[model samples]
Target chain A: MIDVLYFAWLRERIGAPKEAVESQAATVADLVEELKSHSEAHALAFSDMTSVRVAVDQELTDMSAPIKGAREVAFFPPMTGG
Target chain B: MGVRVQSAPFDMGAEVQAFTKAATGAGAIVTFSGVVRDEGGTLASMEIEHYPGMTEKALEAIRQDAMARWSLTDALVIHRFGPLKPGEQIMMVATASRHRADAFQAAEFLMDYLKSRAPFWKKERGADGASWVAAKDADEDALKRW
Candidate 1:
């Protein structure tokens, strides 16, 4: 199981911060597609890929990056922290 | 080395004192603080929202990236969430290095990355009501500089 995290408005819309999921996704984009199919809240939270960013194992990454053997994946909006 | 996400206002003097006190071989410490601003008194207050777990992790990642790219000895990132009034401290970053250049560059890089890469969303509350701040294209362009 891979742990998935959501942040900011994505968390507010999805109603949770983190979860564990079983996935057959090979890349971040594929995993996102699987998540989008899970529920309407998930779909709404991930509606625009351009507005979202992904990280694998705590490093910023592109959606096409592979997710094989990854322990954690996080999704968040453009960062406003500084 | 400290990463904090709190709603309470932070004291820059006290924080800098504490950070410098722990310094050993570090020769320079560069610090940056961001504050809520109102241009021409257009904005009244800002409400910042963040995802608890994911927000922390994202900041940590940014911190690590800064460390890896620069010859910095240590770093600290403090960001505030919740409702904040104008002139309130929004965020602060401190970086230490053996020389001034590394410390300065790392600190600025951290701020740029934090502004464009982190997952906190801001909503400005004004007399007209509340509205979500759109992600600025300039912020995206700023990240490319590093």
Candidate 2:
């Protein structure tokens, strides 16, 4: 099981801040694919890849990055902080 | 070096004074503060959300990079999260160096990284409704210059 977190608009759309998922996905992309099937909200929140950003184990990474031992995964929109 | 992420407000004047005092040999100090703009009375409030553990890590890494890329004596970054009223301070970055150029350049570099690379998301509440502040293409492009 790994902690999956959503932030900002993604959290609003998904209706939760975080969750635990049991999966055997090899990479972040595969995990995303698995998550997309979880529910309608998940599907809608993740439908467009360009609007979503992902981080594995708290560091920014791309979808192709492996998630073999990642303890946490976060999905959110591009940051607008300053 | 210091990187702080909190919901509480910080004293900008005191922070600059303290940071300057701490850097004994620094001949130049540059400080930049980002305030929540009212956007011409359209904005009611701004809410900032961030990844807890990751926010600090990302900020520390950015500060480290700035220190490495510039001749700096010290650096500091403080960012606030949670709901804030218009005109409130959102974040601040300060850099100390032996010369003005390094201090100015490092401060700008830190701001650029914090704007996009940091894990904080901003939501603006205005007369119409609340909306997530979208990332600007210019922000991403700005990083290319460094």
Candidate 3:
């Protein structure tokens, strides 16, 4: 099982900030595809991959990055910090 | 060696003073504070959301990067997450070095990275309603300079 987290509008759209799911997905993109199938809300939040950024194991990474053993995955819009 | 992510308001004056004192041998100290901006009175407030565990790690990594790239004695980054009013301080970054140029450049580099690389999101509340602040392409371009 891996922890999936959402932030900002994605959090509101997904309705939950975090969740645990067991999946055989190997990459972040694959995991996203699996998540999108769960519900309409997840589908809406992740409809456009470009609008979202992903971090695997607390480090910013591309969706194409492998997530074989990552314990945590976070999805959010591009940061507007500082 | 100071990195803090908290929701409470901080006194910038005191923070600068404390950072400078801790810096010890630094001849130059540069501190920058970002304030919530309400354009033309349209914004009522801004809410900042962040990933709790990752925020401190990101800031500490950036601080370490700055220290490695420059001849600095110390660095500090304090970012607040929560609702804030216009003109209220949102965050601050302070850098100390033996020379002004190093301090200035490191501070700017830290700011540039923080704008796009950090895990903070901003939502603006205005007359129309509340909306998440869109990420600017300019911010991403700014990181390319470093």
Candidate 4:
């Protein structure tokens, strides 16, 4: 089980902050592809790849990042903090 | 180095005082505070959401990076989550070094990294509605200079 988290608008659009997903995806992209097929909300939130950012196990990384043993994954828009 | 992620409001003056007290033999100290700006009185409030565990880790990593790259005697970062009213301080970063250049540069670097690298996301609610603040292209470009 992997804890998938959504933040900001992603959270609002997806209608939850976090959820548990049981998947065998190899990479973050694979996980995203799996998530995108989950529902319309998932499809809409993950629609524009350019606007979305991903972090595996709380470390900022790219879409190709491996999530083999990762416990958590987060999807969100680019950060606006300063 | 120290990092704090909280929902409570913080006093910049007291924070600086405490940081200065802990920083010994520092020739320069610089601090930057970010406030919620309600442009044209439209913004009602800003809701800051952050990944609880990752927020601290990211802040600490950035603080450590500054400490490693500079001659900083000490460094501190404080970021707040939850709803904040206009004019309220959102977060602050402080750096102490043996020279003004290091202090100044580190402070700016911290601010730049905190802008895009951190996990905090902001949603601004104005008179009409609310929207998530998008990351500016300039913010990403600014990181290349460092």
Candidate 5:
């Protein structure tokens, strides 16, 4: 099981902060594609890839980054942290 | 290194002191603090929201990135959430290095990344009521220059 986290407006759009999902994704992009098919909310939240950012195992990474054996994956809007 | 995502206000002097005290063989410390602004007199208050776990993780990644890119010994980042008043400190970054240039550049880079990449949302409460602040093209452009 991989823990998926959402933040900022993504959380608002998805209506949850986090969830656990079982996946066979080999890469971050694969996981995103899986998520896009889960439900309408996921589709809407991820419709615009340009507005979203992904992190795998707590590290910011590109969508092509591998996610096999990963423990966590997070999606959110472009950071406005500092 | 220190990373905090909290709703409480932070003291700049105390945070800087902590960073310096935690560092060894550090000669220069650069600190940057972002404050809430009224922004054209339309905003009355601001509500900052963030993904709790992912927020900290993203910041740690940014800190690590800065460390790898610069000859820095230590770094600190603190970001606040929830409702905030104008002039309040919203976020801060401090980097320590042997030379001034690395500290300064790394701190700026960290800020740029945080602004353009981190996942925090801001809602401006004004005379017109509250609304989500739209992501600006300038912010995306700023990140591209890096």
Candidate 6:
């Protein structure tokens, strides 16, 4: 099982800030696809992949990045800091 | 020495003063502050959200990179998350170096990295409604200069 996190509108749309799920998915893309199937809210939040970015284990990475044993995975829109 | 992520507002004057005193041998200091903007004149406030753990980590890495690249005496970053009014300071970056060139360049570099790399997200609330701020291509492109 791995922890999944959401932020900003993604959190609002998903109606959750974090959760856990057991999945055999290899890449972040695969995990996201599996998550979308879990709920319409998930599907809506992830409907457009371009609108979201993924980070595995607190490091920014592409969707194809592996998540075999990551402790945490986060999804959110691009940052607007500084 | 590194980054600080907090919801409480900070005093830019006091922060810069403290950093200057502690920089020791630094010949120059540069500081920058980002404030919430209300471009349309209707923005009531902004809500900033960030990953609790990753926010500190990512910002620290950026701070380390800047200090190493410029041989700075010290570097600091403070970012606030939560609701803030227009014109209120949202964040600050400070750098001290032996030379003005190094301090200025490092400060700008830190800002560029923080804009796109950090885990913080901003949503603008206005009279009409609230909307998430979109990341600009220019921000990502700014990194290429380094």
Name the candidate, 1 or 2, with the larger TM-score value: 2
Per-residue CA lDDT of candidate 5, range B1-146, in tens? 66899999999999888789998999999999999997888789999888666678778888899899999999999999999998999999999999999999999888888886666888889998877777778877876755
Q: For candidate 4, what is the TM-score?
A: 0.98
lDDT head-to-head 1 vs 3, winner: 3
lDDT of 3 by residue, B50-111 (tens): 99989888889999999999999999999999999999999999999989999999999999
Which is the better candidate, 4 or 5, if ranked by DockQ? 4
Per-residue alpha-carbon lDDT of model 6 for B1-146, expressed as tens digits?
Answer: 67899999999999999999999999999999998887868899999999998999999999989977997999999999999999999999999999899999999999999999999999988878999989999999999999
Please give, for residues B1-146, the per-residue lDDT of candidate 1 as tens digits.
66899999999999988888786789999999999988568788999987666568878888999999999888999999999988899999999999999999999888888887776778888888877777788877988878
Candidate 1 C-alpha lDDT tens digits along A1-82: 9999887667778899889999999999999999999999999988888888888987778999999999999887776665
Off by over 4 Å in 3: none
Any residue pairs clashing in model 3, and if so which?
none
lDDT of 2 by residue, B86-143 (tens): 9999999999999999999999999999999999999999889999999999999999
TM-score of each: 0.77, 0.99, 0.98, 0.98, 0.78, 0.97
Model 5, range A8-79, lDDT digits (tens) per residue? 778878889899999999998999899889899999999999978888887778889999889989887766
lDDT of each: 0.86, 0.95, 0.94, 0.93, 0.86, 0.93
What is the per-residue lDDT of model 3 for residues A1-82, given as tens digits with 9 covering 90 to 100?
Answer: 9999999999999999999999899999999999999999999999998889999989999999999999999999999999
Q: Model 1 Cα displacement at A77 (Å)?
A: 2.6
Best by lDDT: 2
Model 6 clashing residue pairs (backbone): none
As a TM-score, model 6 comes out at 0.97
* B1-146 per-residue lDDT for model 4 (tens digits): 59999999999999999999888999899999999997989899999999999999999999899899889999999999999999999999999988889999999999999999999999899888988898999999999999
* lDDT tens readout by residue for model 2, A17-80: 9999998999989998999999999999999999889999999998899999889999999999
| True C-alpha contacts between chains kept, each model in order | 0.71, 0.92, 0.94, 0.90, 0.67, 0.94
Q: List the residue pairs that clash in candidate 4.
A: none
Predict model 5's lDDT versus the native.
0.86
How high is the lDDT of residue A52 in model 6? 94
